[model samples]
Target: MKNLMFFFATALLTITLTFAISPPASADVPPPPVNQVLGLFDATIDFTGADIDREFCQQCHVGSQVERHHALVTPTFGCFECHTLTDGTFAEFRECTFCHQTSPHHTTAEAQARHCSACHGSLVADYDDGHYIPSYATSSFTPLTGGVEPDPTNHPGEYAGGCKACHMEDIGQGIASNATTHHGIGITECSWCHDVEAEATLSIRKCEDCHDVNSLHNIQADSDNDGVITPGTETGGYGHIGANADCYGCHVQSFLAFMSTTAAEPTIPSITSLSATVLTAGQAANLTIAGESFMNTSGGETFTPVVEITKGDNVVILYPLPAFTSKELITPVPATLEPGNYELRVKKDAVVSNKMTLTVAADVQVSAANLTEETIVITGSNFGNQPGETTLGNTLGTVQSWSDQKVVVLMPEAVEGQTVTLVTAAGAVDNTEITAAKATAAVKEKIKGRANKGSIKTKSTK
Candidate 1:
């Protein structure tokens, strides 16, 4: 009896195993793809639409079960295969074409038109120029098999198929949508059509567009670079002038372009005439020319924002335009500098400016009047500026006092100029134009000679 009972239990276990191991009836049909069947198993979250910012999928899948499966399999049997691809790229929702049979691009013509006509009851009658009903109609005389597709025929106002392609026509702005068409995906591409370069700008179409200054000009009234942009009461440069806004707000129109009527006769209005004349060395002079067109706004479009002044390879920056009156005044130039040849310039942002040769001179020493161990004074009419020269031989000495009349100098290395000679930094010296001052350099030279002879007794001791 015990043996028979054991045999029966064993026979029952064998039957259970056979049934469990038998293949399914439709075994000839291949099993669905693992990805298709388990594409989102235990991973229902839509990555694009999901809150990826806070949670990673591994949080839930990380466990002994997954870890055990992971040891021998590429996807660790379950975890990786479910959440990610072998390349590490998280799988997209699904290949769009898998079901749609169209380009994988988001919004094909059929998809875009899917929502229309069915849901919009009143818009159902929104028929094409033809009288044919969408459901019952056929493009050909014979009955259509599946359904006739929407046409892109050259009908008067209809542009199907490429709805988005046509809707992207100029909205009057200088920029165009990055996506060519607006059909299929309908309006979702509006967000996708971002200008990565941010080169495009939108313009206001109505009063609201104008009133919304922030949206119109993209100008925020933040004097400091802090992220917060404060709004102020006063109007100036987009904000209150004293309250962090400049005086340019209400004057947005002040970009007042340069004048246009500049192609007139070739003549400088301010320049009566130009001439060259020699003046005593160290003399001061100014270059002047008159032209009323610097304020001309007619040629404004031709001038861009960048401005620079150039003269025969020499260049100077003239940007960040300064205030100037419509009426003329002496224009500012680079000044208070050592004497040298200069191209006198006056510019409005450099593109339009008056220029001329401006000669500058250094204080020239003409002759010596007073002599001392530490100092030698010169007597010359232009001495203050053309201060007199004092030299023992050839080397130039340090200048002390100068005026239009006489000059005094402290000798750096003693130079004896017994014979008066003129010299300049340019190497040419001699100003016959200078008048004698006080005791006069010639007479002073004679007196110093006699003094030197009498003082020869004292000189031997040194």
Candidate 2:
């Protein structure tokens, strides 16, 4: 009885000591349970004997003091609630301090202040308050429970209340009930099962031990440290501090997608870059890709870039899916381009990137005919710069012509009437024949039609 009284006195003193030193910040540690400070143990250097206040214990604990031959009358919370022996011959246990004495936690708030700073660096001034305590109790130390009690606004359920309310399994049935175990609410440690094999049986771990997570499956940050990615942040059961861990944290598959995939050595053609990130329509954008393989990936999968082009409000199928020019041109495909802003998406061994954009414009192409005044005028392609160019082709006979984007030329003298042919830098030739112009007026009409085609006009100095 005397020892019991002294222990309660110490329990009360522990509360005082905890409050007397310094209380941690609201953000530092979670609040201990309200009843965690329940009555002092009927102290013993070893706790295996009888509970002193047997009568008082019966009041609200809701269980039995003496368990009979084959059954316990109720659930357990305190020690005696589990029953020592049939005849009251109890097995003693050391006080909680004997074993739990080694404090493996933040000894002081100052030491803990750093770990929280990584994300909360913006709230330096609010870190103003702190308190230290040998144990949590009222004394020379002030309370750092944030307020008089656990702050309701700070989400008590997340910290303490959740422990009790979530243990619904404890109230099993009649007197044969079991103290509620935290079934699956994740209030228990996660590393306990985060990496568990699909066939591993679930281990019932203690609730307070949940935060000790390790391994990638138990991880929470950037796998590649690249800043942004898929299935972000949370890596643990809930999207918690453990979730935002490194890339390997929750997604080993995604990490392996990059780390394990082998990029093929020069198999096709190589590009230097991935091209632009954004573009305008018909802008004639050039893609900047480099490497030897027409296609390659972190993995040895064959792949290519599929390009589609569009211009201000006018999107067109300028390029289609990855189509190889030939087996030698496998994977990476270079587009025979037109004019417009383009979007490129790559699929290298099934790993595709978001669409990248670029610009393209073919403004040099334009039309014209010969004037009766002995001057030959030609159009088609972008010409204006060298207007003094000599007219090499004639409208009178079968005229053959080649054009730079700037201008077209009529070869000197052929026949009185002839059809026309055109050639481009890409080696494309067009001979959509037009009527021969025998008279000046007729030649002028042909010039007007070709001009409408907007082919740039030019004359040769020769």
Candidate 3:
């Protein structure tokens, strides 16, 4: 009886081992093949083999899959992550629309039409001529499908095919469905009807048809995508179309007529000259800026004229002056500017005028050793090119000549070694050590030399 039990246990162990070593029932099936054109697996490549791994599938499929499939698949996602294997058969992976039905372009007809301006702005302008419906209705126009000619007698407005007769099927049902019903069709469905080569050729022809080759309208085309049409030599050397001509928005109008009637914007302010080009540093002076359009007379929120003084690339000082009439603006020079050669420019409403040189000179110096009775040369920087007052002690002296580096002044009746102050439009510079004794000593030395020469001549004569 014990021996029979031992034989039964051995038979049970053998059956259990056989089941564990055998492969799964579904392993016999093959995976779908990889579609080379679509770059996806489609019911042909074998996936049920034990040797097939996720890395094997990745070797063939790479990069972005968003254009084909909206969902992104990275290296981490295995083939089974998106595609499920149901009862040994791989689930079919369809196109992007299979999952995401309502994309941005398919949301509404208005949304699609609005997106067309990103590429086909010129086409949209041509369609606004109020002749799109008539153009499409003409019997001479060829339909997209061959052998079926358009019947002008059966013209239906915004019904049946409408714009879709020639345009692709992806352009929404008809023209009436979109927000731009009056504006006509856009190029949202361009890829459905034309290839890349055809699209390039059609774009050129569409722009040329309305604008014409070498015409003012064509030369001023916004082909550079700068949001404004740059005026070319054809338009009398006008720079920016926005500043030169007014189209009153983008409507069908005579370009020449608009250019003739529309007045160009006021010319940019220019700096012809400045009242004082050089001035003493840290002194307040009234500076005059001469230029055209210095004041903004056109009513509204008035723009205050500003003076910008810059040293190299850095802005040293900016003074905002009150509004004034005439072609000149008189403003106070700020006292904060240090001694340097700076560029002064006038700015109004963010437009900078021409630049002029302005020198902020260092402090003045008086030569106490070289003081003369008639003339005293005061050496200083930024002593402007005009004569000014010079005060010796309490007496005011006459300015003989003045320059950026030196000022010559006629001395007044005053004690020697007294404080002398030179005052100009730039401001005042005071020196306490200027002495009249230096002039007296110089005169005595000259007189003594002449007396000695006379005595020597008398001795020789005797």
Candidate 4:
């Protein structure tokens, strides 16, 4: 009787101390249930062990502790309400759809489909109809997953495709288990093989690790010349499994495609300088791109380099040529480009270069001009490629030709003293004055000779 009384007192004291240390409840905490004698050891009548139910746990776990489990329960419910069925079995034991079907707490369809039928096995089974996924068994001649497998009859101690022939497997080799285990959302994606496969999965690899070049897959060669062969995709066709597939056909075609999937040695491009960074809008300029490793030629055929200019949502792709080299490209900036800050990038096929800034200024600037008779040759920057309205005073002049640097205007009605204006879409550039052109020294000499002749005739006549 004394020992029982002491045990009850100790339990009561422990409960009191727990409540004192814990924070106050945010919500109304239910009163603690009276503990029956011997109920601390065995709570339920079945004596299956301590009841893993909800009400039994709330005795000490009052206050904010109530929110820890009930937050997801949404009604006046607890953990056991959703976790366990009435019959004592788990809700998941019925079906994954039981809880995951309509629950707002489930992952999206894109998240599930990304793993290749992890949650939906029936869909994957439909795609495995020999046409999509071939049999790997020796009884079948064409095996999809037999990339690394030795085929003595076909190639004599030769392995077939590459590392991706297994790691990217959808059907065989515990597909769902590997997908959920390796390709978890926000943790790891499908691009791991092409990116950080070797370094990431050094020991705990999803597929069998590549040992050597001569043994199974001849993949020690860094095809991209990036000095790293772990992420197979960047290494060229030699690394990325998708590149080695039979689609590029099976048998002899497959072998050719697999052999041809070598990533060219990577030539990283960088922009060193641009001939002009800031130009007026609607003013075309000969943009010279000086960079390194812009491989503009291959096998004597010149490659058409694409200059991508982006401003906000606007992207303008221009093809530059006639002056294309490994280090330099001379492209024309269109006069129609809007005035804004633009980001320029050079792309050689799939290889993209470094980013460079280009500013399309709004205001046009006139530097110098020469006026001869009614014709005015306005020389300045940012006059635009297309002829715009050129006015001598208020009278509009007929533009003979227009260029970014110079504009020749013929205005028969134009006076010597008049402000010459060049108007473009961007803005207008005006010369302060169109002064009369000075005569040459030869014209002055001719007039003096004529006067001398007249004086001589007059003296002879007298």
lDDT string for model 2 (123-208, tens) is 11112233111233333222111222135587544321122221112111211101222221212433433335534333222211
lDDT of 4 by residue, 1-462 (tens): 111100000111011111111112211111011111100111111212245233433332222221122223322443345445443233452232334343221155543334322222111221222222222332322322223445567755333333223233222221222234343333334443223545543221222221211112211222343323322333222222223332221122254434333433333344555665556566566666764445422223333456777766677777534356555666667777766556677765644554556666545677555556556777766666755566554455667988888888886554433466666533333454454445346433433443233211101000
Write one digit per residue (lDDT tens) for candidate 1, span 147-194.
122343643332222112122223332212323322223345332223
Off by over 4 Å in 4: 1-268, 296-302, 364-462
**Residue 103 local lDDT, model 3:** 27
- List clash counts for every candidate, in order: 42, 95, 10, 5
Error of 3 at 258 (Å): 5.9
lDDT of 1 at 280: 25
- A best-first ranking of the candidates according to their TM-score comes to 3, 4, 1, 2
Q: Regarding lDDT, does 2 or 3 come out ahead?
A: 3
Mark the 10 consecutive residues where model 3 has the least summed lDDT: 6-15
Q: Judged by lDDT, which candidate is best?
A: 4
Candidate 2 achieves a global lDDT of 0.27
| Winner on lDDT (1 vs 3) | 3
The candidates, ranked best first by lDDT, are 4, 3, 1, 2
Residue range 208-325, candidate 3, lDDT tens digits: 2322222212212122333223232112211113222222111112144433333222223445556566565666666666544443322123344566676655574344453333
